[model samples]
Target: MLKIKNLHASIDDNGVLKSILKGINLEIKAGEVHAIMGPNGSGKSTLASVVAGKEEFEVTKGTVLFNDEDIEDLAAEERAHKGIFLSFQYPVEIPGVSVTNFMKTAINETRKAKGLEEMPAKEMLKLIREKSELLEIDRKFLSRSLNEGFSGGEKKRNEIFQMAMLEPKLAILDETDSGLDIDALRIVANGVNKLKSKDNAVLVITHYQRLLEYIVPDFVHVLLDGRIVKSGGKELAHELEEKGYDWIKEEVNA
Candidate 1:
């Protein structure tokens, strides 16, 4: 459902370009989970941001096709409306905006784009309650400002809740396991597993194999120095976790 061909990207406006993605070619079909594992500064997060149409990075080459349409030029919100979702590594806290209000706006905007009416408040609340329970989030969180004063684990759970609410076609989770304890991790993984379907796909970007044990990916890709140097199955993650990324770096330089 997603195809990225010969992708390249850089940052900043002065054209002092440092390419982060070097000729990336990847295809994520529907009903699959793809795990991207890499060391720090390997461009994994950059790829996710680029696909979500984040404005900070400039795509110098390559095409990102979503469901057969080139979406490289689409704005972030436009891409989101097209069913692309990115769960950020660091979720921002918006003071004064209740979680319920924020979610309602996002849901309504997405529905409007699909030519559907806004979901009724009663239905929205019911869905929220169900999803929150599944994620083990307290109902009181719905009344608070998004991510405000929430613990690290609570923030991650909130991100998953938002994902459940949006129901995007493609979900890119950037470091979803960061700062999560074992209990929180299990809860988050269970929510993701429950949400997975034949029609939707997930791209999980992480550093450790611990998360993979909970959410097994169909494919695992190793990125080093801004490129994918190795691709394998679930065992690759185990290898990386055992041997660390230094060997991958050596292989890349060789």
Candidate 2:
């Protein structure tokens, strides 16, 4: 459902171009979960942001194809409207906008883009309640400003709740396990597992294997120095956990 061919990206102005993704080649099929693990500055988050069309980064080369269309040229909102959902590592707080209002606007905008009729308020509210319940979020949480005054766990749960509501085709979760305790991790993983379907895919970018034990990816890849140096099955995560990334670095430099 998603493909990246020889993808390369850089940051800052043209003068400060330092390529973070060096010829990345990846494919994520529907009904699958792919995990990307890497050390600090390995470009895991940069890849996610570039795929989501974040404006700060620039693609120096290569292409990103969503479905059959090339999405490298699309704007971030356009990519989102096309069933691309990104759960940021740092959830942004909107001080005045209630979560309910924010979600409603996002859902409606997506629907309108797909030529679907707007959902009646009652129907939307019902769906939101059901999803919120599944995430164990109180209705009052919906009335609060988005991420404002929310604990770290609360922010992550809220991200999953929004994902459940949007139901995007491809969900890119960037460091979803960061700052989460075991209980909160289980809750978040359960929500993601429940949302998985035959027609959707998830790309989980994490620094550790702990989250993989819960969410269980179909494939695992190790990225180093801005490129994927190794790709393997779920067991690769176990190996990394046991031996650490130094083994991989040794192998790379061998």
Quick one: best TM-score, which candidate? Answer: 2
The sequence of per-residue lDDT tens digits that candidate 1 reaches over residues 83-185 is 9999999999999999889999999988998899999999998999888898988888899999999889888989999999999999999999999999999
Q: Where in model 1 is the C-alpha error above 4 Å? A: 13-15
Best by lDDT: 2
User: Model 2: which residue pairs collide?
Assistant: none
Per-model C-alpha RMSD: 1.1, 1.0
Q: What is the lDDT of residue 104 in candidate 2?
A: 98
What is candidate 2's lDDT per residue for 1-254, written digit by digit as tens? 99999999999856877778998999999999999999999999999999999989989899999998999889999999989999989999999999999999999988898899998999999999999998999999999999999999999999999999999999999999998999999999999999999999999999999999999999999999988999999999999999999999999999
**C-alpha lDDT of candidate 1 relative to the true structure:** 0.93
Q: Mind sharing the TM-score for model 2?
A: 0.98
Cα displacement (angstroms), candidate 2, residue 190, comes to: 0.3
